[model samples]
Target: MTLRLAFMGTPDFAARSLAEIAAAGHEVVHVFTQPPRRRGRGQSEQKTPVHQLAEVLGIPVSTPASFRDPDVIAHFASLDLDLAAVVAYGQILPQAALYAPRMGCLNLHASLLPRWRGAAPIQRAIMAGDTMTGVQLQQMEAGLDTGPILLSETVRIKDSDTAASLHDRLMEAGALMWPRALAALERGSLEAVSQSSDGVTYARKISSDEARIDWSRSAEELSNHVRGLSPFPGAWFEMPGEKRPVRVKVLLAEPVSGEAAAGPGTVIEGLTVACGEGALRLVRLQREGKGAMDAATFLNGNSLPAGTVLD
Candidate 1:
């Protein structure tokens, strides 16, 4: 039997779970998403991914600015929802809203829990050189991702994984958990397990300045840092040019064992820069205002010969 549910989410990551819920034959009573905001180069008002999907699905959508309003909380409670499924919903649900559903709110958090608990778990996990990370289905509480885990699926962090690659992988992994969780919930078989107090780490939001490449760090650490912020707010470094310093983003790289007389940010050979400890072979790069290209393709048009110093 299907449960009467309300879905709350934002962004593409959250949209996947919403689709799965509808596909699972649950009666989605409503959808709550963040309000539209101006974004992009033109700064035009754009609806969130969840908001757009709910429209196409023919489900009623609510874009409440805040759940703090008495009317907002009352409206949600009025849904008479058996349960509410939340994923990557930006806002914090108030205590009243948390208990509005019959079974309270169940969230799909993109982390193993108690570890990497905060705004940017996916990025932070890769940045911190973590060898593992996963998505957990948590029972929502008033605290920030402090809820007990009802279910979890682990995904390995490959050396080649960037935030973008790992994000898609985790999303696919998370989609499978939703059906299993909801079905178990309907069967009265789901269980919640509290997170361990140890190994707790906060994944604070990524800042603009933090994305700048620091060449002085070890090659291995620098590779992780570049992968963590890749493809968006990309890890960038400046290259010395005749006219001015040209900014280049390292989209992909690998830490290699080697030694060079040159210091960090110097091109030792073939797009490989000597780090404070080893060397990094930049596999992919993008110059400002140019499309991303492999190091070979980038070298064909531009020049970053050996002995060249990068800022």
Candidate 2:
């Protein structure tokens, strides 16, 4: 009972699900992804990971700038797809295209639906210090992620969990759950539960403005912020008394119990910084355009003596 599916996705997160769908013996009739855009230092065009993978698998790839065009809509309708699965697909699917598939569209969302239901859900959940989050398979509607849930699996958020780590775990979870969901769909046993209106939260996309570290917050809060943005658009602060306000990105840190009277943003012991509530011991950090290094390694090369406040 292999279902005919049209796969739509772009990034690594989406690619994993696409691979899982193909492995499950489904006929992936077409793949709709955003057109290649200029990227990197050379500003050369780079095809999306899903686009390249779909090409390798010999599946038809479509990169329509807009589905409003009648010709593009005609091509989509020509596929006569049973279902379409979308995961982190950058573009918005039009209402006309939504009904093109027989069984409608299903989305593999990264967060527990009705909570963190927009872009950057994984990072938002971590940054908000949520204790638990999960992946959900939903019936895609016109509204932004406001759809009925078809399947979900919860995962605990550890104190040490970072965005990168949680993202990997969720991807694996999605891969495992998607096949079961599809099997249920084939048997006409898939249940769709309406999402609760309460507990709804939007995960706005991360911005460069939000990356600047504000030392006035609690150590735990700051630690979560640092971890959530780690390995990309890192949480950073400028060193005081430096000629050019050198930015130091905090890659890893741990909260420690301390009652020092040091002011906020003040570097207490060269490695630890006093927060409004507690202190955090920085483990790994990096300078602008430099590779990440351990706290000791960073100190050896670039000295930040004790009491040298950060801004």
Number of the top TM-score candidate: 2
Tens digits of per-residue lDDT for model 1, 1-311: 89999999999999999988899999998999999999978999999999999999999999999988999999999999999999988988999999989999999988899999999998999999999999999999989999999999999999889999999999988978999999999889998899999999999988877888888899999999989988887899999877999999888999988775789889988899988989899999999989999999999988878999888
Worst 10 residues of 1 by lDDT: 256-265
Worst 10 residues of 2 by lDDT: 238-247
Q: In candidate 1, which residue pairs clash?
A: none
Cα distance off (Å), candidate 1, residue 254: 1.2
Q: Which stretches of candidate 1 lie over 4 Å from their true place?
A: none
* Candidate 2: stretches off by over 4 Å: none
Cα-based lDDT at residue 278, candidate 1: 90
Q: Estimate each model's TM-score.
A: 0.95, 0.96
RMSD values for the candidates in order, in angstroms, are 1.6, 1.4
Please write out the lDDT profile of model 2 over residues 1-311, one tens digit for every residue.
Answer: 89998998999888889998898999999999989999988999999999999998999999989877889888988998999999998888888888889999999998998999899999899889999999999999899999899999999988888889999999999878889999999999999999999999999989988988888899999999999998777889987534788888998998878775798877788689988889888999998878899999999888787787888
